[model samples]
Target chain A: MASPLTATPRVTSVTGASQTIPAAAGIGLRAEHYHALLQTRPAIGWLEVHSENYFGEGSLPLTWLERLREHYPLSLHGVGLSLGSVDPLDLEHLRQLKQLIERVQPALVSEHAAWCSVDGRHLHDLLPLPYTEEALNHLVNRIQQAQDFLGRPLLIENLSSYVQYTHSTMPEWEFMPELARRSGCRLLLDINNVYVSAVNHHFDARQYLAAIPAALVDEVHLAGHTRRVIDGVPFLIDTHDQRVSDEVWALYRFAMPRLASVPVLIEWDAALPALEVLLSEAEHAQSIMESDHAVTA
Target chain B: MLSLPELQRQFASAIVDAHAAAQHESLWHDTLLNPGRLTAYRNNFRINIEDALAAIYPVVRRLVGDEFFAAMTRIYAGHAPSRSGNIHHFGAHLPEFLRGFAPTRPLPYLPDVARLELAYHQAFHAGAGAPLSDVQQQRIAAGGYADLMFTMQPALRLLRSDYPALRIWLANRADSDEVPTIDLNAGGDRLLIYRHLDEVEITRLDEPHYRLLALLAAGHRVGTLLNAVSGPSAISRVIQFGLQRQLFSELMIIENTP
Candidate 1:
């Protein structure tokens, strides 16, 4: 099926303003930095927020989002859609998301490629999906349904998994591109998740990066993870509490050329540092994107 | 190979139910997957729900301390698994859960404190309903003052506790560093919690005023509400106070035909 959003122009031209998310680094807008962001108006390219945070009818978060939306091209990244869940789709959640999209008019919308609920019970964490044809078909149909209901395309992100299902038929990199191809959705590639899962599942990170088709990717995510050796087995937990590690940065550098012109986001949810710290992290990503641009150009 | 639905059911069980996790561990033994790795998902489920509860009920946490609060939340999670995908909707039952909890019997006021925090959370996120406009006020004052019915704001939440919940909440708030001793037997409290501009404000209400507003909120006619509250001046005073605080989002006048 053709995507309804395919005909619409990607970059919206407003009165002397571009509504497109620029191919530059942006930061996840957290409540801790709301006031500072408004006061400083840092030279970042754009801002992204978890769509669920502002799902309330009328609250301070929505108010702040409105005020901030005027200055920055915003992206609504949903964490609780549970799109990959086997249960029937949640129409109420879709309704709330559509309302928020109409309110914010975000430049991009996205949800994870993992499920967080089963049998009406929500775990509220991005749980992994098996890389099998059945799972792929299920995810594609769900994403298509969501995109149809949302009246736009969604950027489905990859999950950082610790356990790989033995029933899986293919690798994640293959499954992801195929899902996007079949569902008519774009990919929000998280380089950190790629690196984390690569190590956890014992695959070559570069091979995973190489498998993805560059044209399908719309955004890249950079976040922090912690390394732990549990019961003599090394594990990389996607903590997002600290700085993006040097190893993940190296992986990002490797993936940058393929992800040319895609907007990058620095996500820090827990133990969030000051606005300056996030700005610096964004600056680092901005610098990498620029240096990669120079090489590609 | 298990189907997607069966796998998800087993995985969800492993994360939320400890007994199911042990039973499901053997199913993955044939694969290269280590069953112990499921611990990450288990830990995340606990931490995510606990963090959400802690964010909504900071004062409750402060009153009970970190260790006790963690234990309580674990039990709470088992009893009330989250129904909504949105984590904010997870802990609505904490107040009622605390009422029957055995460990918290000594602190009788804790449940009410939980209720206050929940009210604050609800009010903070409640819809922004427009307050009574000048035209509406004028219409109310023109005639039929007794037959007027007031509609409370969506952000308005009324809570009454047998113990001094307001004092306990004020003392345990994050802004105040000093933990002031609050006498539980001093007096009970009838409190009004509502959103004003961007801040959620809590106000103490006297008996007559609380009764008047409570009745109005319950859709009682102004004349009947006045009859319910004692004292001649108290009715007008309560109405004036409610209007000044923007508690009523709208007002309707009922015509009495004989």
Candidate 2:
């Protein structure tokens, strides 16, 4: 695992952006209005989809996705690689994912930094891991194995956690950059998750971002979250039903300059609205990305 | 207190049997916060699976009202938590779950409806293949057609039930407006679900057509399929139906069969 840390990771050459979002802003690929999206081909930087959604052999989703692929640049954002689990990585899942990448040639591929299943029983939710050296070593080995299998770098995104381990020595932001540095992987800096987790666990989001080794960061995720005020103590739920909150946008504002030109995807997974709504959201991010670049310059 | 693996082992226990409370002493929380947090995880688990079920069984959702469907889904999800992460592959046991469900037994027809939906779902995602063209068909010659075991399309699925499930399903689809109460005794359907070019099409075949497709799907060619079907009229009907659907496309004619 430590050997991979000293090596430069293999990366999928971008092969020139046909119509891709310039590490600027994009929206999640969803089924709510597939027709509307294809007809208009809205002006967004890029579109991402959950890799698992396309695992079906030839459903309407596959058919539409194949059609939609021609109109836009696609990103394969994964939720279920179980990259941090102690259990062995699922090969068949990786094979299907590799098959998808071969077919789609997506511009970017990402998965969560969390684990889901253990011993083959999937909790199905992105569960937190205690950031022990034991855990880090386990995770580093898994990430390297995955990168070797896929033949490219995987951008590992930090998950929004409601529970924190008492034994965790490192914050995810610190751990994430270290993982990328150690495993020869890239970091998918999910700004929303940073805010959501920071609020839930009472940490400084900015400092977390500051601790990140900027060079290893490859992508950014901006998504909406729901606030659960269960007992006057606020816990932000990383629910994709609403708009990107102003607070998260501010955090994105702070984090954007650091990640200057990485492709940013607006991820709305549940309660997905009209494609126009997502397009509008993407435009909002694009405007911000451009505006932030202007101010920095 | 259980170690990390021990914690996970017990956690799996808590999910499946609810008897894994042996680690309850290790749990540290003020109130229902522990159970509430646990419930949130439980809800997340159930909801992820429920979402998969709903995606596959939208026709079932239409048969039972959405509200009723939600309730039944909760019950179904409680007993059958997903075993895999690609939720698309989840919910394979739903047909059997519906069959064994006591509450749904009153609506005995519901189980078959679930079966049809499952078949449709499976067919849609099965796989894509190029249909065999007339030019490709010429290579078979007429002689070996009997011994040639044909291959069905990857998206093809054969499902039968003792209920008017096709009509029930067709009526409940988003395109249709009429809400017809299903008559259980109007009785049974054998559905041929295949991804016909564009959308997944549900074709209701008669007993004979069903038997013929069943035999053919199971790897018998035209002549062997005819022998499996009882009557001449049925054989012609199935052949005619197969032609209409372009079912012979991608037909793998295997020679020297065991």
Candidate 3:
């Protein structure tokens, strides 16, 4: 949550297009935690950051992000906007985002399935969408619009939902693959969310993974979650604050092998720890990916 | 637009008005044990803004303890619902919020502190302009100095607060340990927030200096800006004093080519 701001984030990577994306595990780079990351330069596949974090003009955040971007392939993840809303997209947000994409030249860009605004009023949370055909078509068109505007493809992530829409004729796993196949966008499969959704909605996580087209998946997310029980029924929330749980880790191990070598990220959004903690998590995923790659190679 | 407005309103109502039933009940389980999924969204809203406030006003949060600051956030957020999807733009009005906040009114310096925080946030995201180095100054002819215009960096934030907000901000930085108590009767601050080489710097300024620089920044000519200063010494002092801080990296003269 520390400032990961950019000074002139109109462009990201000069070599982003030339370099091929490697399938490996990385950590979400944070601003408060930058000095430690640089001091140690821990072993990990790469590092990812929120695109909006580095929107400053010549601030320390931008300098540090540029330093890190040089050593690692960067992923630009967006957290703003109510993307699922029926309103027209915020042009200013898109302009800023397009500017950041040019500045960072990130290897990958991703946003959540949930919307964060309505009209001009921002709810500031990733609100869920029902998995109805109407919602699916709406998302497909939105994805196409976003891609056409940005002049590139994007990886759309599935939101972790506590409520299942009765109007939904399908699970997000089903809706998502169709979205990718139709819209030409890719999927950022968050393993933890799959685990959370499986438990909350009573489905098999592997089955959901199986439902996704292998080629459609461009990235994988492994994050921690918290569970609270109400009336003896436990509901898990995707609070990216802790280490990846063993159950979710197992789910990742199951899901990762299917996707083979997709880039995996370790996301810890709350109560963000020191750089070493996040780096270690990143290294753990890196080791898994390395081991998998070794066996495949 | 209507759909987003209605959805946002319904989402807002569901979170802010506990008595209102969720319009999208189909999304929840049909059982009696829904046990408030709205709290998740509510907490998410509060937490995100609280984080934004922390980003903007860490000094304020540190000064008022976490618990009191959180209570303050609830009051501040309730009155100032965010209007932008970009969370960075969420807390722009916190200074006004603190000025009217009943509990925080006791901390006479709180509103100014909030102003400093907002200024820092503004400075961070402000546009990136080409640095006006002295080399660029060579392009301007001496005769055209009066008529030559200058463009200030977008990250610059000019302010006058009723407290030593700059010193307070420096003393209360996340890395600093010096705790300074501020007296309510103490005089205010005139400060400028500008970024040089990616580091946001908050420099204190005098009245004439503040007025002259702000005027010039607002695109008035050197003659007008000088005239606006109260005294004759104001012009020279403003230029000399401001030069010591290095506000301009470049200055190009206007050449009317007919």
- Report per-candidate DockQ: 0.39, 0.32, 0.35
**Candidates ranked by lDDT:** 1, 2, 3
- Tell me the tens digit of each residue's lDDT in model 2 across A64-174: 787887777888888888887667799988998998887767877889878888788776778776676777887889999998999998989988877666566776776
Off by over 4 Å in 3: A1-18, A57-59, A292-297, B1-9, B22-35, B63-65, B133-135, B139-144, B170-181, B230-237, B240-244, B249-258
Q: Candidate 2 on B112-140: residue-level lDDT in tens?
A: 88888888878777764555555545544
Can you write out model 1's per-residue Cα lDDT over A132-204, one digit (the tens) per residue? 9999999999999999999999999998998888778899999999999999999999999999998898899
Candidate 3: global Cα-lDDT? Answer: 0.73
- What does the lDDT come to for candidate 1? 0.86
Give the Cα RMSD of candidate 1: 6.0
Best-matching candidate per DockQ: 1
> Per-residue CA lDDT of candidate 3, range B1-258, in tens?
123345446666666545564555542334213426667677777777787778788899988988887777777766877777777777788888777778876677888888888887787776545544444433332333444455576777889988877777778888997777756567888988887665778888878778787886776556545456685466556555545555653343444421
Q: What is the TM-score of candidate 3?
A: 0.88
Cα deviation of A254 in candidate 1 (Å)?
1.6
Give the interface RMSD values of the models in order.
12.1, 13.4, 10.3
Candidate 3 per-residue lDDT, tens place, A52-71, comes to 77766555577677777767
